[model samples]
Target: MASALDNPLLFLLVLLFPLSAMAQTNGTISLGSSLSTSDNSSWVSPSGYFAFGFKPVADKNLFLLAIWFDKVPEKTIVWSAHRGNLVLYGSKVELTSSGQLVLSNNQGQEIWTAQVTTGSATSAAVLDTGNLVLLNSNSGITWQSFDHSTDTILPSQILDMGTTLSSRETETNYSSGKFELRFQTDGNLVLYTTNLLTNYLYNAYWSSGTAGTNSQMIFNQSGYIYLRQTNGSVHNLTLGNIVSTRDCYHRATLDFDGVFRQYIYPRNWAGESWSIVWSVPSDICTAIAESIGSGACGFNSYCILDYTQRPRCYCPPNYSYLDSSNTFKGCKPDFVPQSCEPGGSGEEPRPQFQMTELPNTNWPMSDSEGYNSKNEDECRGRCLGDCLCALAIFTGVNCYTKKLPLSNGTIGTGTTKALIKVPQGNSTSQFPFQREMCFSFLEQEGI
Candidate 1:
């Protein structure tokens, strides 16, 4: 038994062995197959359109064990094994010979495992439909990624009763977000905002209203999403299926803003990105307003529909987001909060806050007081004098005062104006008093 180190050429050959294996991977992977992020290798699908392996998370210096559209410029992830956990360099995913799919960290500790109970896997394959399947001895699928889905559902995918899809924390962060789409066991399909810390589902923002009839969520090959009832009747969730499945790739995702949208990308369209074909509950900022929980964006942040038709969250004057990178985390006051206690002589302290105007904006919910006859100035004055008032809404004819954690905030079509009370410091922080100017500034800088 001669050692490989005994010959220099043999040692070099050993170093290059893994790279050679990477190039030879095809549609079907062997039982003992493995890949790693350090080598940047993957088990590519037959058409080379999809891959199952570890991918580098941009700018974060981490890797994700997931499946994605391999040829796309964005390399959009369709499914991830562990959303809350990310791995460092040298991490690898392997289909163990013992019939288990395991993701291991650089230190060789298990991070995630695909659950299987019926039988051991004989082989695994990345199917053309973007599904990663583990086959049994008879080549029957024992486990598949389509069954335990995350946020996006590809064409030909089906969501049976009780299946849920969770949005990511942000566009870039892979952690579970505040929104979710659940097909309840009662046959109702609904979209909801979830308590991230507790996983408690709040009010339903949208629903199919087919409860007790038994329904299944299906994304057909032609790029249409519909709910099929037990009686064989189908109700389309998305209106049209104009995009041909043969010419384009499709996916329906529960976006982090709590909107469910269908998108398509032409197969031959050069240098293009995913285009939204349809969305449900179009006005997401107003759709989720309820007596409990933060609305579409987060507490203390207003939600607006940007040019892209997606929700855009912004922090008001004298308030900054709890996290700058992830606006959905909400905001915090930059200065010390007003003192609610009176002065030493029992006289109320001088007002330390003033109102800054934002036109066409309103915190639709969370009203502390409402005055039918108050004008804009009176609304502003009322909020400024009250230590409990965080904001005031004056809609030309009436006024409403709001407290902390403003919810259901939106850029409305009505004449509603938001008077946000902030510390009477930082003179440059105020937008121009003119309604037009204030709206323009809010739109331009999201102040």
Candidate 2:
């Protein structure tokens, strides 16, 4: 009041106040503050339950700016800013004086940013409810993490129209995957799978089947998700009887394997395990056969229910996995390819390919020429005659001659059989032996 610059002590106090206030602590990051990645620096919530910082991805030096359960043993990440884009070590996330929050790599390249118009006095805080917000006097909240979610939705978070939750590329990779759960403009909550190479097209696999204006999806504190319409009607999105319990955290996620599931985590539990309470499309193989790019497994592989009742990928007879480390890459022929020309020494003609019977198996979509036949024998004969037919599916006089790289194959309680053509010289005994070896290798690797 009396010319503060005249006094040295008062001037010093004035200069240090803003710097002291900018110090990050108690989950708050004042303007011009930064958190380093190499140092493992983070902003922890008041209760120390959640932390926002850089997380290592699968033993690689690259890291992702993510929010995770701090107390859990698994360090389960619920949200990520740049999921598909990883930053190198020694990166830093800083809130500039201009109110812009930026994530920069070690080479000083900006990886991501929140270009908000908060005043210079803006400050960021990580709330106990797992929301990261930036606030200032000019605007209450200029930015928030909940407004741009990655894959998981927490309780009290509203998924408004045009919002989506994208699944991660894999259990180990933090990049975007093929599945997405979106709140459509028509007021329907839909789950879809996208071709990674072409993001423009999507195939819906599940939907809420409701339409109304001003619709919103919310995850309640009682471990239930519901879609509330403008007419005040609530449609339950979660399945099964789930009850609320104290000290428990619930999250709904679009899983990497193209499934939407709700899970619960008990804070006081000894093992710190998460239990799946509900899931959509209860059967993974129930996707529509005619839908484009609808299958869970890749081409040349079949989806089957494993011992644990989870969908697993398997290669057919005389075929081996293209990439042994990753089953999603699909399979390839292990034996010699059958030539179109008939080969024999005498007048007696030799069969070039042998039919291997795979009962209860069928491909999702028929990518072949359809033929009307009297029985399975005729269907097999038709496929054997056509050089382009790699396999044939026979179902009650309906024959589908599939071309190479058969996709979306599934095994269930259906009356269909897939007649796969293998090289005639290859012995059938090698099929079981190769399958057993593959299973044993996977088991030993603990996959």
Best by TM-score: 1
In the range 140-191, model 2's lDDT, one tens digit per residue, is 8888888988888888788898898898887767788888888998998888
Candidate 1: 10-residue stretch with minimal lDDT:
427-436
Instruction: Go through the candidates in order and give the clash count of each.
Output: 0, 0
* Residue 312 lDDT (model 2): 69
CA RMSD of each candidate after superposition: 4.7, 5.7
Candidate 1 deviant stretches above 4 angstroms: 1-16, 19-26, 345-351, 425-447
Worst 10 residues of 2 by lDDT: 427-436
TM of each candidate vs. truth: 0.89, 0.85
C-alpha lDDT of candidate 2 relative to the true structure: 0.77
lDDT (0 to 1) per candidate: 0.81, 0.77
User: For model 1, how does the per-residue alpha-carbon lDDT over 1-447 read when each residue is reduced to its tens digit?
Assistant: 989899999988878787426433655677777888777778777898888888777644688788898777888889998774689988888889898999999899998998986878988888878999988989899899999898899999988999999988888777788888889999998898888789888989999898988668888887788889899989788885468878888888887777888888888766647988888888897788798888888888878776566777877777888987888777887776667877787675664777787878877788999888557788788887788888888988888889887877677676778888877765334432235445666776877
